[model samples]
Target: MRYLPVLASVAALLATSGVAVASPAKIPVRVVLVTTFELGKDSGDIPGEFQNWVEKLPLSEELPAPGSYHEVLRYNPDLHVIGIVTGEGPAHMASAMTGLVLDPRFDLRKAYFILAGIGGIDPEFGSVGSAVWAPRVINGGLAHLIDPREIPSGWSDGFVPVQGDRPDLEPVPPLHSQWGDMGYTLNPGLVNWAYELTRSVELPDASSLQANRVRYKGFPKAQTPPAVMVGDTLSSETFWVGARMNRWAERWVKYWTENTGTFATTAEEDIAFMQALSAQAKAGRVDINRVLILRTASNYDMPPPTETAASLLKEEANETGFSGFVPSLDSAWRVGSVVVKELALHWEKYENETPENK
Candidate 1:
C-alpha cells in the first residue's frame, strides 16, 4: 500500500503541474479582426478602432492573451471570429501580432487577418472618411534624415532612401535582400478583389466631414465625398505633416514600389504588423496571402490652405478634433464588416481557397 500512496502523490503532483493533463483542442479561428486601439472599454463607451467590432459583431467571449498588447481577446463563437486590440504604434503592433500567431490555443493556419484602422489621408488622393484598401505597405522610417537647414541646396527635403545617398536616386538599389522588410506587397489579387467587392460601399458622410474637406481648395479629390478606393500606405512612427512631408510621402512610396504605388494613407503600425505576420507565415502558422489592410481617413496628412501644419496638428492632438473622427470609424466598420461577414459565413469555401483564388 506504500507504493499505492506514492503513486497517488505523484499523480496529484503531475495533475497540479499540468504534466498529466492534455491541453484542450485548439480553437479553429476563421477570421481575426485587428484594431489598433480602443477609446475606453470594449463596448458601451466612446468607440475607438475596436469598439464596433466588439459590440456590433457581439464578441461575447473573452480569451486570455498572455503576451499581446491587450491581454484580452474578444471572440464570437458562432462566427468563429476573434478580435484583438494591438494598442497603438509599431512596437505594440509587432508584439501583439507575434503573440497571436504563437498562441497555441488557436489554430490560425487558415485564418484571414483583417487589419482595420484609421489613418491620415493624403488630401491629393482621398478625403476624410474615405475607406482605402492597400496592397503595398512601405516603411517610411527606413531612411536617412537630416535637418532641412543642413540639407544640400538642390535637395527637396532631408529624407533619403536607406539604400541610396540622395532622394530619388537613379536606379534604386535592390532592397529585396537585406532591407526586404522595409516594404511589403500584399496579395494583389486579394486586394483587388476586396476593392471590387466594397468599391460601392457608401461611407458615412456628415456635415463636419464635408466642411473639413472643403478647406482643401486646390485638391479636388479632397472636396468630394468619401469613397472606397485602392491606395498604398506609408507606415512610420513619426507623425509628419505639411506640404513638404506629403510630397516626401508620395515620392517615398513611389520610390519603394518602383513607381507603381500611390501613397494615400499615412499610418504607424502596418509595416510592423506585416513583418510579424510574414514571420508567422514562414513557420506555417498563418497564411500571409489571406491578410487584408483597410484604413479609413480620420484626418488629412497635411493642413488645408486655410491652416498651417503646426496649427492643424495641434488641433488634431485631441482625439475628437479630427472632423471625420466618428465618420471614419463608421466607415471602417461599414466597409470591413462586409468582407468579415462574407468570410465568416462562407468559411468552408474561404478555408480552402482565398477569395482571390476563387
Candidate 2:
C-alpha cells in the first residue's frame, strides 16, 4: 500500500516518455516493392535492384525486419509504400518473402507486391535493357538432370521431369506437395492493365547496350531497341549459360505451362517468392492475385553468334560486367514505379478493388 505513490510516479514518467502502454496497431501498407539485392548502402552508392527505389521513392522510414534477408525495410510513410531487399538466390528469396508475409508489423492483406529486378533476357524475345512483365513464373530448379555424355541419343539435353523418367513426358507429373507447383500464373487482367499503362514509356538505350546488341547477328529482336513487353520468366538457382541450356529453358517453360508460356527472362528468385506468397494467400494473410513481377534485361542468357558461352559467361562474372546493368535498373524503376505510384496515389479506390476490376 505504501508503494502506491511510487507506482503512480512511474506510470506518469512512462506516459511522459511517449511510449505506448499497449501494442500499436500494425501499419497498413498499400504497396510492397520487392528487389533482389542492393550494393553497399541504400543511397549514394552503386545501385543494384533496390537503390533507385530507396533513393527516388525516397523511402525515408526504416522498419526492422527480423528473419528477412536484408533485415531492414524502407518505407514511404505518406504513400504507405514499403521496399525490401531479399538478397540473391532462391533460398534467400523464400526466407525473406515468408518472413515478410507473416510479419505482424504490417497489414498486407490488401497490399500489392511488385517484384522488380534484373534478369538475363532471351535474345529471341527482347534485347538488353528491355522491361518484361511476367504473367507466368516457371520453376526451373526442380528438374532432374543427367550429364550430357550420359544423356540418351535422341534426347535434347539431360533434363527430365522430376517424377518422369524422360524429357517432355506427356502430362508432366502433377505438382508434388513437397516440391510445390512448377508454374504460377498471375492475374492476366491486372498484368495487361499494367502493360498498357507503361508500354509507351521509353527505356534507356546506352551506346554500350547497342554495341552488345549488334553482336547477335541472326536475332532481329536482339538488334532492336529495348521496349516494354509481356513475357514469362524462369527461376533457377543454377546460373546456366550456352545455347543448349537456353533451348532447355524454353522447352521447360513450354512444358510446365502447356506451351502457353514463352521464356523471356531467366532469374533466380521469382518462383521461390511466388511459392511463399501462395502459402500466405492460402492463410488469408495476402492477396496473391495482386502480385506483379517485373524483370528487366541486364544481359542475354546465351552468347551472341561470334562469341562462345564460356567467353560471355566470363565477361558477365561480376555485377558491373553486363553492358545493360545500369539501364536495366533504370528501366525497372521507370516502369514499375508507374504502377506503384498509381496504386498508392489512389489507395482509397485501389485498396478495396484491384486495377483489373477498374
Candidate 3:
C-alpha cells in the first residue's frame, strides 16, 4: 500500500474539513503613542520606543503603514491603543505622521495623540529627567545663519528670523512672519489638564543626574530632581549647544508667543509632527484639541558656565554630556502612563467630551 505524503494529506484533510486560518482583527486605536527613536540592540542600530510600549502593553496586532518611517504600529484592541515611532528628525517625523494619519487601515477620528520623546531641556526651567507639557512649539530652523563675528555685537546668536535682512537689535514682534514660518500651540485646557494629572507622579532619578544638577549650583530649579511642569518647546534642525544658542531659543519662544510661551525643551521633530496633525484636523481626520506634546529632559541645551561648549561637545570623557537617556525615558513613561490610564479607564466620559483643562 502506498501512503500519501503527510503534509499534502494534512492540507487536504484540513481543506476538506473546512478549517481555515483566520486573520488578526484590525485595531481601532483610541490612544496613539508617538516616539522619535529607541535603543538599538547594538549601540547604533536603533530599535524604537514602540517596542518598549508593546512589551508593557497588551498589543496584539502589528499593523503596517506602508510608507511610514515607522512602518509598523503595535496595537491593543481592548484598550484601543497604538504606538508608533517616527524615526528621528523633522523630515522623517513629518512623513511618518502624515502617512499614518492618512492611512486607511485605522480610524483615528476620536483618538488622542501623545507625542512622547526626549529633548534638550533649558536648565533654567528644569533638571534632566524632568517631564514637561508644552503649551506652544516654536520653530528655530527657519532662520538665516551668519557667522557670530559678522553679526552685530549686541546679538547673542548669529541666527536670525528669515523675514529680516539682519539680526534684531532687540527681540521684538513678528518672531516668525516670513511666509512659511510660524509657531504652534496646544489647547490650553488640554495642556493644563495633562499637567494636573501628571504633576504628582514620582519621576525616576539618577546619581549622574544629581551630579549634573550640581553644575547648575545656583539655579534652584535645575539643581533639583526631575519634576513635571508646563512650559513651551522649540524645534530646530540644529543640535545647538552653547550660551548663545540657549539665549536664541529663549528669545525666539518669547517673541513667537508674544511673551506667553516659555521655552522649556528643545527638539527637532515636534513642530513637523504637529503641522501634519493640524492639517489632518482641518480635514476632520483628527481632533487637534485632544493632542498632547510631552517632552522629557534628556540633557541640557548648554553646559554650566564653568565648562565651555566646545569642551563639552568635544571631550572624550563627556561623550554626550552630563545626562542619560534612561532617566528621562523612565520619567516620561512614569508620568505619561498616568494620563493614558485615565483616558483608557474612563473612556465613556472622555470619549465624546473634552476633559476640562482647568
Q: lDDT tens string, model 2, 61-162?
A: 777776677889988888899999999998899899888887767789999999999999999999999999999999899878999999999999899888
RMSD of 3: 6.6
Q: Best candidate per lDDT, number? A: 2
Better of 1 and 3 by lDDT: 1
In order, candidate lDDTs are: 0.88, 0.90, 0.77
lDDT of 3 by residue, 1-358 (tens): 1121343457567877999844333346678888888655312343234445666654556665566765667667678788887888899888888888887666888889999888888888888889999988888888778987788776767776666665552444355552125688788898899999888899888888888888876678888888899998999877888777888889878766767778999988988978889889999999988999999888888778799888756642331343656787777778787887788778887888878832
Cα lDDT of model 1 by residue, 127-179, tens digit: 99999999899999888888999999888889887677888687776773223
Ranking, lDDT, top scorer first? 2, 1, 3
- RMSD (Å) of each candidate, 1 decimal: 5.5, 5.3, 6.6
Output the better candidate (2/3) by lDDT.
2
- Residue 239 alpha-carbon offset, candidate 3, angstroms: 0.7
Over all chains combined, what TM-score does candidate 1 have?
0.93
Over the full model, what C-alpha lDDT does candidate 1 score relative to the true structure? 0.88
The candidate 1 region of ten consecutive residues with least summed lDDT is 1-10
